[model samples]
Target: MPGMVALRYNPILKTFGERLLASGHAPKAVIGATMRKLVHMIYGIVRTGVPFRADFCSQKLDFQDGI
Candidate 1:
């Protein structure tokens, strides 16, 4: 699955998945959360026309308001 592959190859996604599991999320739920994060990251990049930065982990994105 894309989530599993992301976890294997993407350090950011890997950490996210691990954090979710540590918080008592199920395996499937963690995968789903990672997938959702992947989609949101892609959308944010495209919507903002900005290059992706590996070190970006500041705050939650407010995509609804176009931020």
Candidate 2:
């Protein structure tokens, strides 16, 4: 799926997935989270008519209380 590929090739997402795994999340959970994030990103792109940028988020958004 696209989420898997994103986790494999997208540096930021890959790091996120890896961190989740390290934090004791199951494989399925990681994939589900990844896909969920992809959906949000895609929705944002469609809603705003903006192109995707890897650094669009940068450090402006940080996870709190997991996710």
Candidate 3:
């Protein structure tokens, strides 16, 4: 449910979802990947003891493969 909300409302994930769809990926696969991405992001924040920041997250996404 959180992943679905992120997919709809979060700009970074929204863009990533669009790209995946455009590349012929299945919708379910895209959602699964987005969910994984959200988990990774959450892990990073917890590990760093920092709050979530959209700008910082998007910048990190820039260097990621296929994003």
Candidate 4:
């Protein structure tokens, strides 16, 4: 399902899920969070009229101190 795909390929969700697992979160909780994330992503794409772009989706944000 989409949850499986997100776990395998969606970088943001994949990393988030892994971190939650490492922190001792339940597997079902992780999967549910990932599914919610996927839904939000789909909604954003639909609202913006932009095709799903894996490259864009996988980009990591760089945070600088003192914003």
1 or 2, greater by lDDT: 2
Identify the superior model by TM-score, candidate 3 or candidate 4.
3
> What's the distance in Å from true for residue 26, model 2?
0.5
lDDT of 2 by residue, 1-67 (tens): 9889988998768878888898899898999998898888899999999898988774654463475
**Candidate 4 lDDT by residue in tens digits, 1-67:** 7887898887777876787787788898888877987898899999999898766734452221111
**Candidates in descending TM-score order:** 2, 3, 1, 4
The 10-residue segment with the lowest total lDDT in model 4: 58-67
Candidate 2: RMSD to truth: 1.6
Question: TM-score of the candidate numbered 3?
Answer: 0.82
Model 4 regions lying over 4 Å from their true place:
53-67
State the weakest 10-residue window (summed lDDT) of model 1. Answer: 58-67
Predicted candidate 4: what Cα RMSD to the true structure?
4.7
Question: Would you give me the overall lDDT of model 2?
Answer: 0.82
Q: What's model 3's lDDT at 8? A: 99
TM match of model 2 to true structure? 0.84
TM-score of 4: 0.71
- The TM-score values for the models, in the order shown, are 0.78, 0.84, 0.82, 0.71
> Residues 20-63, candidate 3, lDDT per residue (tens digit)?
88889998889988999889888998999998877766766656
Query: Which regions of candidate 3 deviate over 4 angstroms?
Result: 59-63
In Å, residue 50's CA in model 4 sits off its true spot by 2.2
Single out the weakest 10-residue window by summed lDDT for candidate 2. Answer: 58-67
Give the lDDT of residue 24 in candidate 3. 90
